[model samples]
Target: MPKAKKSQAKPKTKKAPQKLRQQVAALPVRLSEGGQIEVLLVTSRDSRRWIIPKGWPMKGKKRHEAAAIEAEEEAGVLGTIQDKALGHYRYSKQQADGREIGCRVAVYALNVTEELADWAEKGQRQMQWVRSEIAADLVQEPELSLLLRKIGPP
Candidate 1:
């Protein structure tokens, strides 16, 4: 019998790129008695690191509006959100299912009108009002630190 010929296999195909996603964040701010600017920060549910209130975009609401809502829910703040975004930062979000997905966050300034005594997630998170320089030192993300350092009028 003749020797059998070998068959060649096709190479594996490349994977498609992961879909990009975005979220809205609120940087709550207020003027102190000494006429200094202050930025509000909240702790993350998992790591307890200082961060702004942020969450997934809401349907039918403007990005700024959604950011304001996140501020209220996560940090017990009510404020006027700037119509435009202050800036943006990117990070990998860790989902409950253990998936770390890349995400870009649009940050809006929320001129704090009031601070509620109680709000959603109040017990689960800690909130603080701090100076911009101190806030810059506390946040983990460099881009976010830059944003915090620059937190001022416009």
Candidate 2:
């Protein structure tokens, strides 16, 4: 009797896990006429979901400074930003190749002092200043919503 031929199969290789990318965000805010705290939110470029101004770390810039710059460019707002981060939130960003990468964003409080009528990304997004409670309800990120709910008098 002839011996049975051995099966031939290639071994599966595991793909390397992607590292979590670091990002910074500015929680722009101001006081309403009734002395209630309000937050400034901008519509995301792709999904149009409400979000705070955020971006990747800028070269040679501190984390808080980068957050402030993102607020100006994305939301057309500028203000005094706290150097320390208020909190952090995790989210997944879709890349051009359709792969999702995990991102961790450090949020800093920005006391909005100036809002420009014309600025970068002006027409690309819609912005609103809502009471913190309402702002919490508007955002889709649960962690961000919790941060909004925790905001109190400055």
lDDT per residue, candidate 2, 1-154, as tens digits? 9999999888888988778899999999999899999999999998899999999999999999999999999998888999999999888988888988999999999999999888889899989999999999999989999999998775
- Candidate 1 lDDT over residue span 1-154, tens digit each: 9989888789889888677699999999998888888899899999898899999999999999999999999989997899899999988888899999988999999999899999988899988888888989999988999988877752
Off by over 4 Å in 1: 1-17
Worst 10 residues of 2 by lDDT: 9-18
- TM-score (C-alpha) between model 1 and the true structure: 0.87
TM-score, candidate number 2: 0.88
